[model samples]
Target: MQALRIAATGMDAQQKRVETVSNNIANMSTTAYDTRRAEFADLHYQQLRAPGAISSSTGLIAPAGIELGLGVRTSAISVNHTQGSLRQTGGDLDLAIEGRGWFEVTLPSGDPAYTRDGAFKKTGEGLIVNSEGYPLAGDITIPQDARSITINANGEVYAYFDGETEGQQVGALQTTIFVNEKGLEAMGGNMFRETQASGAPIPGEPGLDGRGAIRQGFLEESSVDVVAQIADLIEAQRGYELNSKVISAADQMLGSTTQLR
Candidate 1:
């Protein structure tokens, strides 16, 4: 009976791993996408000892110890916050981070969220916004007639107007850091929110206090590795099959005890 439960646990763990790998593949092209992975730990084992309650003539030594692991279970599916690669797109609004920091964005709920995606654009009102129309944090706006826009590694927004020899600073973009970025929970749409486990936010300018520097005309690429994921998938499949065999063997042994002749 307990053996069946043990095998069931192994099945569940392997199934979770499969789901994790699938998600990683789905977001392989997503900007700033961090990979998700499942963790497992073995369950407690049972030991059998003693053939009789009282044995005066025989030694009091208990029967040889036998470890019977119940099963394996998933411990956690943590988000990997490793940095992604930066790609040049030749777009003024496109931005990418060079270190550990997140660009703050306004959410639909009027709350602030963080993102690594820097595909930004200017609205009709000259408001700098992301693809979702969410305004960038710190309020950066450029003139409609601005000839060309440029940003510096220090997050200084510059605008070049017609007949202007040089660019002028229009706005400043700031970055936010966390003590435990992996603790942040992703709410989809390339957004992430703070959590207690993530600790408090530490705001700073680009290239200051270990904050990430800004890269104009670039985007961050997903950090998922396809080869590693496929290998992990195969490992989980084999593990699940082995557990199934254990369950079947236990069943056959139990069936042999019955005699219908």
Candidate 2:
């Protein structure tokens, strides 16, 4: 009976691992997506005999103890914050970060959110917003009559008008960094919200003080590796099958015991 319970926990843990790997593989094409990994910890152990206990017959002390582990449990599902590959889109509004930092956007509820997805678009009112229509922080606006827009590595936005031979500064963009970026909570729509674990957001200009430089006309791709995920999937499947076999063996043994009349 104990073996049955222990093996059941293993099956549950492997099921969760499979789900996490599947999600990562599914998002391989998602822009700025980070893969998540399932972490597990061994359950508590039942100590049948204490270490260094004196043996009755030989009066000798034992060096090792008899302990049985309960099972495994999922500890945490952490996201990998590694940088993804950048692809050029040739669009004026598309942007990507070359290193660390994220773009700040205001949600519809007026809450501040951060995102690495830089596939932004200019609204009808000339306000820079993400694909979800969430406006970027600092209220950057482009002039409607501007012939062309230029964003530099420093995140400075400039617009060239017809009569003006020189480009005029429209607005500046800022990047936000966190003390513990992996601690941020991932909200849907390629956004993340600050949590107590993530600490406060550190605002700064791009390409300064460890902040990543802005790359216009480019977007960051998802960091998931398909081959690795497939390997993990196969491993999890094997683990699940082994645990199931253990349960089956335990059941047969129990059946034999009941058959003894």
Candidate 3:
């Protein structure tokens, strides 16, 4: 019966692992997406005999204790924050970070959200916003009469008007960094929310104070690797099958015991 229970836990753990792999594979083409990994921990152990207890026959202390692990449980699912390769999109609003940092956006509820996806668009009011219509922080706006726009690596925005040899400065963009980016909570849509574990957001201009430089006309790809995910899926499938076989073997043994007259 204990074997049956222990094997069940294994199956559950493998199921979680497979789900994680599935998610990663599904998001392979998602912009600025990060891969996730499932972590597991052993359950409580059943100690049949104490290690330091005196032997009944020889009156000597036991060297090793008998400890049987109950099962495995999912400890956490950690996100991999590795940088993804950048692709040139040739779009004016498309941006990507060369190193580290996040773009701050204001959610509909007036809460600030962070994201690595730079596929931004301009609203009818000339306010720069992401695909979800969330306006980028600092309220950078473009004028209607601007002929062309230019964004430099330093996060400076400039617009060129008609019959002018020089470009006028519109508004500047800022970047946000975190002490522990892995501690941020993923809110889907390539957005993340600040958490206590992630510490407070560090705001500064792009390419300054260790923040990444902004690359115009580019987008960051997802970090997921399809081949690796397929391999992990196969391994999880094998583990699940093995645990299921253990449950079947335990059931047969229990059936044989009950058949004894």
Q: What are the runs in model 1 whose C-alpha is more than 4 Å off? A: 44-68, 258-261
Clash total of candidate 1: 0
Model 1's alpha-carbon lDDT is 0.89
What Cα-based lDDT does every candidate model obtain? 0.89, 0.95, 0.95
Best of the two (1, 3) by lDDT:
3
Candidate 3 CA-lDDT value: 0.95
TM-scores of the models, in the given order?
Answer: 0.89, 0.96, 0.97
Per-residue lDDT tens digits for candidate 3, residues 23-52, read 999999999999999999999999898789
lDDT of 2 by residue, 1-261 (tens): 899999999999999999999999989999999999999999999988888888568899888988899999999999999889999999988999999999999998999999999999989889999999999999999999999999999999999999888899999999999999989999989999999999999999999999999999999999999999999999999999999999999999999999999
What C-alpha lDDT does candidate 2 achieve relative to the native structure? 0.95
Q: What is the Cα root-mean-square deviation between model 1 and the actual structure?
A: 3.3
Per-residue CA lDDT of model 1 for 1-261, tens digit only, reads 788899889989999999999999989999889899998999887755334434345656444555687888788899988888888999999999999999999887888899989999988989988888999998799999998999999999989999998999998999999999888988888888999999988888999999989999899999999999999989989988988997898788778856445
Clashes of each: 0, 0, 0
Ranking by TM-score: 3, 2, 1
